[model samples]
Target: MAQIAVDSSPKKKNFLRSPYMLTIALLPIILAAWWLATTVTKSVPAILLPTPESVWIAFPRVLGADGFGDQVLRTLTEIAGGFALGASVGFFLGVLLSSSSRLRAAYLPFLSALEAIPTVILAPIIIAWIGFGIEGKILQAAIACFYAVFITTLSGLGLAEPNAVALMKSLRASKWQTMVKLRIPTALPVIFGGLQLGATTAIIGAIVSEFIGATGGLGYLMLRYRSSFDTAAYWVIIFLFLVIGLVVYLTIWYIEKRFVFWRRIEVTRPDLEKQ
Candidate 1:
């Protein structure tokens, strides 16, 4: 009998397939295009679209004497507070609604109506009632987040497998146990999906509130810069806003990846020997 030898080899990583690499690659092209538009061709007026170097130079001034750092901190704090309040209320309400059909039927219409009204419209009223401070901004963010979280959470809870519920019931599991052991875990993916949307909406709400009325925040900073026609500083502030939004989104994405591990796709590497 002849013996056959098997070879095992590691596959080479495809650098171009990496999402991070692709994103990083795109940045230089975007910057070049922006530079060409602003500097070379001068298609857009300098007053409107300042060069990248101007924005870069404005960063230190914006961060230092302009108090841009403080404004960022203020906005972040408002987002955090509002998100916490909204998430708490939404989660509890969703649980209540899911557990009680009668309550769900009675209150869902009202909740939907509230959600239908644009959150930006409420910003003025909130500012007037609570004053142009972090509190009002927080309330606006909370209101913006509330509806999305509530609706998604309710939908998630409803989507829990009926067979699992029946099994829990047959096992004499208490309502609380059923929720903790079955419903919540089942609903986590959808709930996190809602949370992602809520985080974005919360940021938008805070900014809108600040735009309506605020002593300090990025939105207010943008308004001040726009009025002065200091386009460089305006772009810098816009960049900071983008950073903040990216951070919020990435944070939630990280949480989802960690806690919702079961939903992650499994990547299998092919065996070179088999091939």
Candidate 2:
């Protein structure tokens, strides 16, 4: 009897044998490390780095504390408001700048300088001027969001081939029509790249602003925990930040993938991946 043959011509082998399972496995490894240092080995002091169990216990108490819900609501509101305001202004400014060489040259340097300023310093002054309320926090997030979106939008629109624009002009397409029908769609992927950066930057801006002077917010909670030396509660706040940042990042990533379905996107650094 003839034996069956199998074709195993070279194809892309996954970097890991069991990608999903391996990813999940890392969680246990991290947890074990935390447990070993805090519990078994007792190498890390509890006050500085509380045990995982203590953090877990602190979560409910923190969530149930008075005004906790309001604090969370305020932070979320600031993020939403700031992101929307900044992204919109950035997009329009990008369009205007892209249309005018003189304007782009005149203002881009100033924008870049603003972007270079540290959020910690920028936030405090903005908070003071805007009066230590939600307005300042929103403005802080907006500034961070604006620069990322502005830079990306400008680059993305410019990515449109010169020949493509000439071809549109040959067909007697007006500038507005050319933009709507040709440029915007071409720029989506790159614009979304800006938005992905904006998402996290917005969060950073809001939190940093809250740190300057605020009666409520996750940052305020974190400050209170620090003052009291409540390591477990502080860890809980840290975890909340991690979760929020991850959610915002993942949300942008998902949207990017959804809209740019024609091309594949990778979350991992492209430099590390094999060609």
Candidate 3:
């Protein structure tokens, strides 16, 4: 019998497979490309695309010296208030509509039509009615968030397995009990999807409202900087907006991971088997 040779080389880890690692790895490449484009090649004008160093310098100054903290706080307040109002109303309305086919048929089309209209167009009208205050901003954010949440939630509720629902009914389960124990769990992932989309939309809405007319906020700051041709400062403000949007999305994602554990299990099980 021939002796078999045993290979004992350790498996190399693949960092690129990790999402966080991939993001980290891409940052330097992106920065280098931006720097090269602006500085070396001059493909983009410095006025429009400021140097990365200039933008980096502007970041700390904006945070400390330029009162950007107050602007960020104000914008966050508007987003929080708007998201709360919109999500609560959307969830309840979705539940009501899902409970009745006739109601869904009557209202869903109208809701879709309203969603089709750009929310930014309403910014001027909202500002006109409510003035350049936080109220109008909140309203704008809420309107932007509402439809996505409502439609997604309605669809999620409708996805409940009919056989499972029938089984629950045969066991004499109360409507509320069935909803709480079965329908809600089934719909959570989809509802969370809507919430995630709504979160980003709410931020956009707030910023657009600020752009139209606002006493303060990042959008107002961005407009000010742009008007003054301070491209570096404008980029800093844009970075802050990106950070805020990321924070909102990640917060929603964390909540989903905590509550929607079943979905996580379902997704991970296949990957685990492959491993």
lDDT of 3 by residue, 117-188 (tens): 887799999988989989999999999998889988888987778888999999999988888888878999
Q: Sort the candidates on lDDT, descending order.
A: 3, 1, 2
Q: Pick the candidate with the highest TM-score.
A: 3
Give, for candidate 2, the lowest lDDT window spanning 10 residues. Answer: 2-11
Expressed as tens digits, the lDDT of each residue in 27-69 for candidate 1 is 9999999999998898989797999889999989888865667
Candidate 2 lDDT for residue 188: 86
Q: What is the C-alpha lDDT of each candidate?
A: 0.86, 0.86, 0.87
TM per model? Answer: 0.89, 0.87, 0.89
Q: Which stretches of candidate 3 lie over 4 Å from their true place?
A: 1-17, 268-275
Error of 2 at 166 (Å): 2.3
Candidate 1: stretches off by over 4 Å: 1-15, 265-275
lDDT of 2 by residue, 1-275 (tens): 56422332244766666576787789999999999999899999999899999998999999999999999999999998999999999999988898889998899999898888988888768866878788889899998789889988998888777888999999999988888878877888999989988878999898988888897898988889889999999999888988998888888889887887644433233543354
Q: In order, what is each prediction's RMSD in angstroms?
A: 5.7, 6.3, 6.2
